[model samples]
Target: MVGRADDAVWRPYEDGGSLGWMGTQGGTIARDEDFGGLARLTYELDDSRSFHALSCSVTGWLLYHRFFDNAAAASAAFEEMKPALEALLTQLPEGGPSVPGNARLGGPILAAFTVRYG
Candidate 1:
């Protein structure tokens, strides 16, 4: 898991990306793709933990969305994961993340959210 700025020595990795390479020891932190010192961390975590996470940086906040598979599998995962995810994020007193109910596209999308840590 990525910690605060003073937690590790961060360095650039990919294009517009920064990573605090820990070499599997633990805790590899990454910043956003802006190439600025204040970039948000991009973490590829929780691969073996039953779900895959897709993340993006928007307006300085990192957003995460999850899924298991398509069709029936996605439905199943959403049902099982929704409560845990909601409980974890909505615990924030800042009213948690809100769905704007606005998007450019039509059709379906798995729930998307941003986790703002102090």
Candidate 2:
């Protein structure tokens, strides 16, 4: 569901609560039409990497990813934050805003990851 920087819909996460992870400055919500109504809630970090929780209306599962400068870093960060991410995942609501099946929510995170690693 990721979009190019020029085309992606980006909005800051306004909810006023700590994300329960370190180095997180804030987060953004991204939406796109090509990802089966996937919404991505992505958190910005002090480091070059970022974290995300990808959700859709059809499933309660939250896909987690750590977008880092490199695969090595991503892997390491994923490991370091696995427990916290899992806990966060449990707390996220199921079935976000209703959108078309082709819509995607995590456009910015997906776009950034693709550009940096793909």
Model 2 score (lDDT): 0.35
Per-candidate clashes come to 2, 6
lDDT of 2 by residue, 2-91 (tens): 212343332322332424443232333331112223233443333333443322221333343444444455444434443333333333
Model 1 C-alpha lDDT versus the unseen true structure: 0.32
RMSD versus native structure for model 2: 13.0
Q: What TM-score do all the candidates reach, one by one? A: 0.24, 0.24
- Candidate 1 wrongly placed segments (more than 4 Å): 1-62, 67-69, 93-118
Q: What is the per-residue lDDT of model 1 for residues 1-118, given as tens digits with 9 covering 90 to 100?
A: 1112343233343653345443231323332232233232243333345433323332222344443323355344434443433333222223112424223121112132332221
Q: How much is the lDDT of residue 29 in candidate 2? A: 30
Q: Against the unseen true structure, what C-alpha lDDT does each candidate score?
A: 0.32, 0.35
